[model samples]
Structures are given as structure tokens and as C-alpha cells.
Target: MAVGATPKIRLSLSEWGQMFIAFGALAWPMIKALFGNAPWRMFGSVEARRDYWRNVALVMIRTGGHWFSIRHLQFMMPNDRSACRLWGWMNWTSVISEQVDMTHGAGEDSAAKTERNPSIHWVGQSPQPVSTTGNNSQRSNVKVVLYIHGGGFVLPLSNGCITMMRTLLRETNDPSYGSPVYLALAEYTIAPYAEYPTQIRQCISILHRLSSRYGVDPSNLVLVGDSCGGSLCLSLLSQLLHPSPKLPQLPYTKGSSEPFAGVLLMSPWTSLATSAPSYTSNAGSDTLPPNVIRRFRDTYLPKSPDLSPTSTSGAYKRVDPMQVASLSGRYYDAVPDPPIKGLTDGAGATRHMDSFDAGNNKNDEWWKEIGSVAKRIMITTGEYECFRDDIVTFSNDLKHANDTSHGKASEIELLRDESFHAVLVSDFAFGIPPCTLAAKLSGWFLSVLRNPVV
Candidate 1:
């Protein structure tokens, strides 16, 4: 081989198949638009306005494409060992507390400041001095934001995630509430590299590290995630509330049984097993198409043997067989009946505990156990998002579980604003929903700290 020669690239059939999926995802929206022009372009509906601004904000972050676009193609297209080495830099990042440096915002100014000052001052895996550019002082409040960034479980945290965290920490300063926030960005292995529950276990590791090192109280820690990250957060919550024998045990659980302070989910991808009404009704309005959604689903939890015409099961079969199995049952099999009661939705509607006959009491006990964890759960979804219905279902299911267990329904506050899927995670130039949503999140975090339930 010559010193300055260009290397020839070859992709396996599987890689080619991935590329085909990527092309399909890219083309689906364009094809839909061609058939009957997007509603946002036609009628200027709230949904259209949201879709427009969010994409604009995304573009402002960087050209080429969104982080997911790059990740999607990279995962699908096969590369040789040499090519893998060349692209390995983009695939993953280290998760060690001392090594991970998350600068709050974007732009050359933040970059320059980070370069000059010790942005992340690590002291033996403990909470280091978190200093902003202007202040140069330490934050007094002992709050940590454990962020699980979203990109269909394939992409790493984008500029959007970094910027959102920076903005939230900067803007969310209330004189009344003296909570200082430090970010602990959770980095997990993406799929095609690792499968479903592996991401869950990685999250547990991050949680443990944050607790053991930073001395962050499990209750003071806020589990915040968007898209699939949101899904992971909820999944983790379910596991915590109701432990399963099949699943591995989580270490460093604060040496106590109390749950985290609060859980905030932004446009969580809850149900990948099937499509919701929003998948079709809001398909054109959403940035993510149905096929693209399924592609990610296929990568993480491929079609089960029963579902597929082919009898063989793929390596990634997390959701395949489990689709027919009751995950709730599995998790709650060993958990005792929950002690908490009076769970309800924001609407003040509650289910009657005795609505079902005594025969179903065993099932009700599991729901109760699941409901007892998490003092606060804030579910925010873009009204026109493809995930809207599933989120609604998730909320309702939790509410029902609370009702069945406690004999009264408790409120699960849901914010269904006019926006597209992943509005908060995406960078936006001018959008009412994203900004308002951020403010709401700040307020919620403050409330959680000031008036912690547990």
C-alpha cells in the first residue's frame, strides 16, 4: 500500500440492508410531501408551525444533518476494521466521571471559556467545582441533572442536548428557590453495538457512579430524558419500583428504597410494538416518519419470531417475545403490595380500586408496586408528535395502576403542548412550545427540590 493512497470501501449485505432502511427513512417524508404538500406549508396549523421552527433550530445547530441522521447512516453502513478505526471517534464516548466534560452551551464563546478555565474540576470521582464562565464561583445547591440524551438509541448527545442543558442551568435561577444544578450527562452504548437492556444497565451504572462519587441524593437526582432516553428513564423507573428476577440487579441504590426526586420525560418512545393513532394522523406533522421509527425499533428490538414469517429470532430480540409477555408481571412478581395511595392524573380523575373483581387483586398489587415509586413524574409531549397517543396511554396506565393499588387515582401531570416530537431536545430558533416547555421544566425541578415528597 502506498503512503498517500485512498482506501477502497466495501459494505456487507447487512450493511447494505441498513443503508436501504436509511434511504427509505429519508425518502418517506419527501414522498408524503409530494403527494399532498405538508400541512404546515399549506394551512399554517400550530403543528406545522412547530415542525417548521424545530427543524430550523436543528439546522442552526449544524449543517450536514442532525446527529441522528449521521448516527443512523453510520450504524447501517458497514465498514472494514480500518474504516471502523477511522469512524470509531464518532461512535462512542467514555462514561468515567472524571473524563466526561459537558460544557453547558454552544458557540465559540462557551468553547473558548471551556478551553481557558477548568470547566469540569474532577476530584477523585467526587463532585468537582462547577464553574460557569462569568461567575467563576461554585454552585451552592447540591442538585444533579442526570440527562440521558436521545437519538433513537443510536446517536450520541448532539449540540442540542448540550445547549439545552446549558440553557436550563443558566436560565433556571429563581431567587425563591436556591437550588444549584450540576449536570451528569449519562453516556450509554448505542444499539447495533449493544441491545435493549444493556442500555438500561448502563444507565444504572451512571446512576450508581453519580450517587457513590458526587454524593447526590437519590431523591435530589432528577432523571431527565428525551425520546428513547425518556423511554429508558421510564423503563428504569419500572425496574426500580418493581424488581424482576430475570433482569440483573442494580448496584448503589443509595442504600435505601426511596425513588429519585422526579422523572421528566420529553416525547418518550414508549410503545414500539405497535403504532398509535398519532403515527398516522400526525405522521406528516412529525419530523420522524413511521418507517424510520420502525427502523430504530428493528435495530433495538427486532421483530419477534412469532411475528415474522421467518421462524428464526434475530440477535436483537428484546421486544420480540416480550411483546406477548407481560413485562409488568415479570417485574412485580416479587414486589409486595405498594404502600403509597391517592395517585391521580392532573385532570383529577381517579379509578375505583375495587372496579375489578377480587380475582384480579394479584394483578392490581403489581400495578400498585409500580405506582408507589417516583414522587413526581412529568410527562411532556408534542401534541402533534407521533408519540402523543402512546404517552397518553402510558400516563393513563400509571394512573390506573395507582388507582387499582391505592383505591384512589393519583395525578400524573402531563403537558400536551403544541409542538412536534422531541421539541425540547432539538435546538429551536423561535418556538413558543420549546421555550415555555423549558421554563415549565425549570419550575418543576425547583418545586421538586423545595417540596420533595420523599
Candidate 2:
């Protein structure tokens, strides 16, 4: 089987036993919620408490996310087709998976062979042929949203992410938006199967294919990601602005320096450190557990010597740049040893840092170039989520960067809602009612599309 490939649907006896144990464990919480004695303090908002099923689902996710192995969860969750069928909107929307070449225009020999080829799921309208006219007239008003799903970089694409995309597609194409929108969900290789630059390389390949083959304009593409996926998006931006030593530089067809129209980050996991004030303050309110975050971090960026080039492990045989760079890259930050107290609490604390200041000493001038990647940028986070402090600090740094680079404070926008981590997508995934967050996100997208940067 290919690394990170979707496993066969058949479940082993152990998996079945685990499922049984999970159900048995959840019974008490189910009973409590049934009797109106549910732990409301644990939930992020009143809206989450209102839905019985959502409450139950949150408990299951919180428990399973912390306890269960990635393999077990992969089996329990439905495959892409099954997820679409469960939604019953499969008929209205078209979902097609295509294997994208990760070569980035390099010949076969130049590219490393891996079983985990990056694929994309075209959700609504697939790409149309570009006009041969001098102006490329037909694609002038078209916008493609490349969605990188959030699962801490380990879990598969969830049904909630699809629901969120469908809703965004419908909302963005409305008359109010005044533009035709298409969504392509990126399916990159997850962690443990692949690490660091591999996922970033896959994303670059997707972008390359979209522009080179489909003739989509780079300026017309919007990058959207949530959670760790948001981290990937930030990595992509960093790669574009300052090319990673390990990955190939993306070839922009138009030769225009600007690569994207807009970027939307939903509850981006900016820093992996669990010592942030929000991690302690919002522990009860947010659905994400700190242990789960640590597990995902370790799996994605393992410190074991086995991953060294001299090691014999075939899975991660080569010593990638991540092994050398560690977490002090442009986006991801290394966890502090002694741990910084309230590091992200104030703008002054974060303004001088390069990437989430976990005591890194990198020069902060590189951040000023962030405005060159996209015309407009919007980052949304939950006020009660564990990542709130980090996202806030990152946003502040990003705003300062853009202001310093472009002299426009309006170029960067931060939307902090009174909810938990990834509440909008999670709500849609659990079939919870649409909230103001969704509407606000839709408005932001519309505003971006309506106003072209050029």
C-alpha cells in the first residue's frame, strides 16, 4: 500500500474491538447529556451546547482524538465517497479526484518517486478551457479556491470540511459576490507517511498544475486552509516569498511576482508550543486537547535519529531539510525549552519575532515581504480556542509586516469570533445550524473577489 494512501475499508478485529470500547466509554457522557447534566463549560459556545448531537460528537472527538491512534480513526471515518454519500448532496456537486504530478515541471528523473502522489478533489465546477485569444478573456472573472483541510496533519479529510467548502461555494457564487467561484480540495500526503517539505512540495505541484495545465491565473486563485492545514498554507506563502532550500521554486506562468489573489486562514495552528496562555486558559473551552497537539507535532516532525540519512528505515530514508532546519523555519516554530510565559500576550512581544516567537533569534525583516505573496489576507480564529493567543500574535506580526511592506494596514484583516477552534467547519461537519461565522467568512470572500488588488 502507498504511504498515506486511503486504506482498504475492511476493519480488523482489533479495530472493531476499539470501536466497541469507544462506544462503551462514550455511554456515560451520552447519558449525562441526555439528562441535561452535560458539561457546558467544556464546550466553546452556547451554540455548541444547543445541539445534542454536536455536544456528543465533540466529546467523542475530544476523547478519540487524544486516545485513539491515527490508524483506528482512519478506519472509523468514512472514505471520500462514503462521506459525500452521507451528505446526500453528492448529486448536486461534482467530486472528482485527479492524481497531480508533483514534479513541478522537472523531468521524471529529477523528481523523487513516492507512493504518495498528491491528488485534488474538484468539488463544484472543475476548470474550464482557457480562451486562445490574446487576452485570455474567458477566465478574467473566474476564481479558484484551493482548500487545504485541517486535521492536525495526520487525520484524513473530514466530512465537515467538505460541508464547509460546499457552503462557501454556494455563498461565494451568489449574486452578491458577482463572480464565478470554483473549489478544489487539496489531498496531500499526511504525516508519518510523509513529512515537512513533502506536503509543501505537493501543494506547490498542485499550484503549478492549476496554472500550467488548467490555465488558471495565479492572481485569481484564493488559498484557504484551517488548523494544521493553515500551517501548510503559511508554509506555502513562505516558500513563495522565500523559497525553501529543499523544495523547487514555483514557476509562475505570467512572470508576475504576485502569486495569489487572497488567503483565508481558519484557526491556523501557528505554533506547536502548548505553553501559550490560551493553551492553559482555553483548555476547557476548546475541543482540541494539548496531548493530541503534541502527538501530531511529534509525528509530523519526529526528532528520532532513525530518520537520519544513515538510518535504514525505508519509510523516511532520506534526511530532508526539515531534519536539518528543525521547527525554526519561516512558519513553524520550535517549542521553547523552559517555555515562555505569556509570549503571545502583547504585540510588542511578537512584533520582533520571525515566526511565532518561541525564543527564536531569526531576523524579523523577512516578514515584511509577506504582502508580496497575496493581495489581501484574512485570518480567522476562535476567541476561546487554544490557538487563540498564537494566532493573535501571528496576525499582529502579519499586519505589522504588511503595513511595513505596503504601508496599508487594511491589507491584513483579523476576525476573532466568540467560538472554539475551527467552530465554523466543525459545526458544518456535525450538521449544526449555520452561524454568523459562516456569513462573515462569506462576506470576506465576496469583498476580496469584488475588489481586485491591481
Candidate 3:
């Protein structure tokens, strides 16, 4: 070596490799301990844990971990992928049966039937008709709330969610909506197999299929989705754009066109691309690390940097549900080279961020494209929720979407505080703070769903 040459602190290849392994081992447990520790546990009781695991499993799959991987199987991993799909399915089955009885009295036969049926029965392959007092002859102003349960993409509905759903169903008739209510809580398909477009497609499918069955006036429809469900709400509205894109495909709703009168999002996961301010701001407050969001991408997308080499990828980007409506105009782009407007030219554009220029596009172009869908797009979440900033940013975008469209169709409401992840459910069973947070969440969402705009 030259005498004057500066020496570098070089380690042997083996030493470098050892360092990485050590960090992975040390770091993995450090993170897990944060979740496993009692004070940090989001699900304090069986009711809450069931909801918590469902989201955890779904997020795990997205990060490229297989269902049976050491990480995912701690819960009923593969017994049912739908079971694995987060939220909205069955977190709280009994809550509805109780609500049904409290709302609609049970005769001997009715009570017996309800006893046998329970709310879980409401979720079966062949759902029985929901008992209501309204006569079929003349329908009044019926309020319809499209409730989306928040599970990472796994676990069925929870008691908190079921109670929440029932309360909304009842509120519509409580002189609040001034009409009898019919609720369609989306039992959307979850990932690993269903992934991206599949969940959103099924959400729209249910809306179209049920609108006729329930006599739902398209104009009176309201959409509500929490956590992963919130993602679904964004996906559904994105499809309803005006001058609708018959081209520029998005897996969430590539070939559908169904719209809602309004939408409500709770603790939603919005953009999957950028690092928003909340990532750091709400970092410690998150019961689940933000990395879980990235982990969920592995379930369907191809092996990207966010996922491991052994991880898989699909033909889709997991699809961010609440990207500002303005950025959604890939379908509105006039450029032929890039089928998706605003994205870079060619196949590479579908999954990568290249020529992303939503600013150049006309204001309200996406809102106009979404046309008159989801008149009231409101969100309710706690400040401590890691997803807070994302929702805030998206809220700003929705305001922008409304301004550009020059339409009064869009609006939002916030119920924010230091409550942690899934505060609606978690706080009830755990946390020093009284658990009325979820109840308030229920009330907040119902108010918006009822559209008492002031």
C-alpha cells in the first residue's frame, strides 16, 4: 500500500454478513416485544385480540410472509383465508343478535329462531332475511349505510364493530335519517388469493347485487369502511369517477362502475407510496408498527424491495385505497403511450412511480371522473393512530378533489385524540382511558352517514 494512502475500516465478508444476521435477529424481537408487551397490546381481551390478530395476519401476508410462516401461524393462519382477511367479517357476531332483539322484539318462534341464528348466521353462505317492521307495499325514505368492518383483512366482525353496525342501522330509523334503514356491511374478499382488485371488485359486486334486492336508491347510499375497510371505501369511490376510464387499469376496481351517496372512513390506510409526516409523528403511538402496512403488500405484489427475496409479487400493486381523488385520474390521462394518465409510459408505469404528475391534470378531474359519487367523504380517527397523518393528507386531497370538481359533493369530519391504533375497539377492552372511544366512533360515523351536514 502507498505510504500516504488513507486506510479504510474494512471488515471481512464474513464479518459484514454476521452483522446483518445479528441485526435481523435482534431487531425482529425488539419489534415483537413492543407488540407482545402488556401495556402495548391493542387487543386486551378475547374480543379485541380476535380483531387484532386478523389485521396482524393480513398485514403479515402483505409483507411477503406466507400464511404458514413462523410469523403468521400463531393464530388460526390458514383455516380460512376469509377468516384471515382483516375486519368486516365476524369480529362481533353476538352483538347483532342482541341488537336485533333489543330493536325488534322476539316472539317465541322469532326468539327461538334468533337464538339459533345469532349474528354469525347473518354472515353465512345463505343469509336469512333480516327481520324489519317496514311493510313491502310502500317504502319510505330508507337510509342505507354501506358498513365496512376493519380487520387487517382477516378476522370477521367484532362485537364493537357489530354493535357499531347495529347502532347505525337503528339510528337511520331513530328520526335521525327520517327513514327505515337497510345496511350492507361489506364482507369483502381478503388477500393471499383474493388480493387487490378482488376485494374492491367484490365490494362493488355486493353493492350492485344488493341495491336491487334491498330497493336501495342509488342517491341515498352512504359508504363506511374502517382500517383496511377504509381502503376498500377509497377503492370503491375511485372506480365511480366521471368520464370513467375504460382503460388504465387499477386492480381495486378495474372494470366496475358503481357509486355511493357518501363515504365514512375510520383509521384508514391511505397512500402506500410516500413517507407522510405522521410516520414519525405517530410512530411510538402506533400499537402496530407502520411496517405492517408494507408487509401487507407481499400477499399479492411481486418481490419488491419492501418484501424479501423469498417473498412473492403479483401483477398488481396492493393498491392504495385513499390516494387523493385527484391522483386517481390515470384513466383520465390523454396520453396514449401511457394507458394510465399521469403515470410513466408503458408497462413499467403500472407499478412504478415515474411520470406521476397529478398537478398538470385539471382540478376535480378525478372528482369529476368519480362524478357524483360519495357526496360526503368523511373520516373519524384518533390522533394517536399511526394512520392519522395519511388520513389528514388524504382529507386535504378530498377537499382539493371537491374544489377541482367545483362540487359540494365532498366533505369530511374528524374525531381525533391521543387514542392508539383501532382505538374504537382496543380502548374498550384495554387502555386506562375509558373505552367509550369506539362508542363515540360509532356515533361519529352514524352522524356523518346520516348526512347531518352543517
Best by lDDT: 2
Superposed by TM-score, candidate 1 places the C-alpha of residue 318 at a distance from the truth, in angstroms, of 14
Q: Of 1 and 2, which scores higher on TM-score?
A: 2
CA-lDDT, candidates in order: 0.52, 0.65, 0.44
How are the candidates ranked when ordered by TM-score, highest leading? 2, 1, 3
Q: Over the full model, what C-alpha lDDT does candidate 2 score relative to the true structure?
A: 0.65
Report the lDDT of model 2 for residue 360: 36
Off by over 4 Å in 2: 1-16, 38-54, 79-91, 104-112, 130-141, 175-179, 253-255, 302-363, 406-410
Task: Tell me, by TM-score, which candidate is best.
Answer: 2
Q: Measure candidate 3: CA RMSD.
A: 16.2
What TM-score, to 2 decimals, does candidate 1 have?
0.61
> Taking the tens digit of each residue's C-alpha lDDT, what string does model 1 give over 1-454?
2110112234566546555554555464444443334435434765556655555543332221222233434443332222222332343422223322222212213222222111121111235444445523332337777777777765554545645655665544444555456666665656545554456656655555554445565556777889988878876665565443434344323226455677888887766633367877876567665545554554554233433424433322222211111222232222221111221111101111222222332323444654345667788898877788878877767666776764323336889888778877664324324567888877777677665653
Predicted candidate 3 versus true structure: per-residue lDDT over 1-454, tens digit per residue: 1110001124456545544454454455445534754533454775455445534433333222211221222122322222322323444332121111111212112321222111111321222233335543222245566677665553345445544555545544566544455555455434443333445445555554444334454456677777877776766565444212321232123124233556777777665432456656765456544444444433333234433343234422333322211232242111111123332111111112221343434323444434355545667666766677766766665676666664344554566655555555543322223345555645655665565554
User: Which candidate do you rate higher for TM-score, 2 or 3?
Assistant: 2
Candidate numbers sorted by lDDT from highest down: 2, 1, 3
TM-score of each predicted structure versus truth:
0.61, 0.78, 0.56
TM-score head-to-head 1 vs 3, winner = 1
Rate residue 300 of model 1 by lDDT: 58
